[model samples]
Target: TKSQKIRAELLFKQFEDIKHVYYYSLELGKIFSTNYDKDVARAKLALWYNKIEEYGYDTFTTVANSIENHYERILNFFVNRSTNAAAEAFNAKIKAFRASFRGVVDMRFFLFRLAKVYA
Candidate 1:
């Protein structure tokens, strides 16, 4: 672990760009992890985006563009701090059920069985 840490430190020292990206990503993660109000979150994200734009890293530029594109959807997280986990879990269950049978033969019957089991 110490060796790994030393290696990481050496790499970061050698590559300033990598260090900037890594720290910036961590700062971005911290913004989402905090329980800020929607307005505050918007302001923080805007500030972060501006900083990233000024830095002008290609990776962060692409990420900033995506964040701009999905700004409203991203902000929806602050409304209730919810995610699509339940829907995703249900989808995973369905996929597992289908896999257990190797494949679906009768589409109608498969739906009936899925409803019976899941409902």
Candidate 2:
């Protein structure tokens, strides 16, 4: 909870002039695996394919294509780290460390504290 207000205030700054927009990207194979209606889901998957082509792509498409092209090992990666949780967790930890040093009321004491805590 150290410096939570400062963190929240900083986070709130990002939304100061925000605009709302909606964009959808889909993972059709996963949807179909547990889909309620087989026929409708299949049709929807086709529609999503068409929409993706219309919307085009960015770098992720290349990476996704690589995954499919490799197919053997990378599909296993997609299964395990389904989301980017590991990377996000590291970033969150670093942010917390930065937050704890916010006041830095005493440089000598702060350095000592940081060294003791992180050493």
Candidate 3:
């Protein structure tokens, strides 16, 4: 696995454009891992956004725009470092259940089954 990872990194190095994008992504991940004060975190996020913009990758640009649109709400994470993981997981489970059954034909029955299984 270590060798495989090295090979992957080498492959990534072959593409100059991709290397910049990957490095920016890694920096973003580093920012998220540390517990900085709100102002510091906001500053770091702004810097990250600027770097992403400089790279001019279409995908990263879309992500940066979304972050800018929700700038204030995104900064709220620094206040308590909380997330909506539980709610997201529940939504995923409901989606999987619906997919497994192809569709929910009866609303009442579906609600009952969901209560029994997930509630």
Candidate 4:
């Protein structure tokens, strides 16, 4: 939508800081989307970290600190872009079942039902 792009450009012009944040987010998306080799992606991620640090934005800085803390596990994505989406979905399903039950009165029955559904 060229019109939407034009409108966004106009709006972005009015807010320089917002524009920077927006573009930086878009750049981060690009870094993930690009099918770069692991080495290149790692380097890009490091560079992105440094760039965000330079901005000194508290929100991005907090995210940077978290990323730094779990950097190794995070970087494992470069291996094959693997994710815990399936595990998350399973957890969600379990939560939904729990919510539906309100509370499990019979522990054995609940375990059997959970095994039937999930195992």
- The predictions' CA RMSDs to the true structure, in order, are 2.7, 14.5, 3.1, 1.9
Q: Arrange candidates by TM-score, highest first: which order?
A: 4, 1, 3, 2
Whole-model lDDT, model 2: 0.52
TM-score of each: 0.78, 0.28, 0.75, 0.85
Q: Clashing residue pairs, candidate 3? A: none
- The per-residue C-alpha lDDT of model 4 at residue 37 equals 72
> Whole-model Cα lDDT per candidate?
0.96, 0.52, 0.89, 0.87
Residue 118 miss distance in model 4 (angstroms): 3.9
lDDT of 2 by residue, 2-118 (tens): 698677567656754221111233355554344235455445545655555555565435544554466445333334335467789867865687687776567788668667765
> Using lDDT as the measure, which candidate wins?
1
Instruction: Output the better candidate (1/2) by lDDT.
Output: 1
**Lowest summed lDDT window (length 10), candidate 1:** 76-85
TM-score preference between candidates 1 and 3, better one: 1
Q: What lDDT is reached at residue 5 by model 4? A: 94
Kindly give the stretch of ten consecutive residues in candidate 2 with the minimal lDDT sum: 17-26
lDDT of 4 by residue, 10-110 (tens): 98999888788888788888987887777898798899999999998887888789978988787778789888889999999988987899988998998
Question: Largest TM-score belongs to which candidate?
Answer: 4
Question: What is candidate 4's CA lDDT for residue 59?
Answer: 79
- Candidate 1 vs candidate 2: the TM-score winner is 1
Give me candidate 3's TM-score against the actual structure. Answer: 0.75
The lowest-lDDT stretch of 10 consecutive residues in candidate 3 is 13-22
Task: Give the alpha carbon lDDT tens digit for every residue of 14-119 in model 3.
Answer: 9877778878888888887899888999999999998888878998999899999999988888889987788899999999998989998998999999999975
The list of candidate 3 runs beyond 4 A from truth reads: 1-14
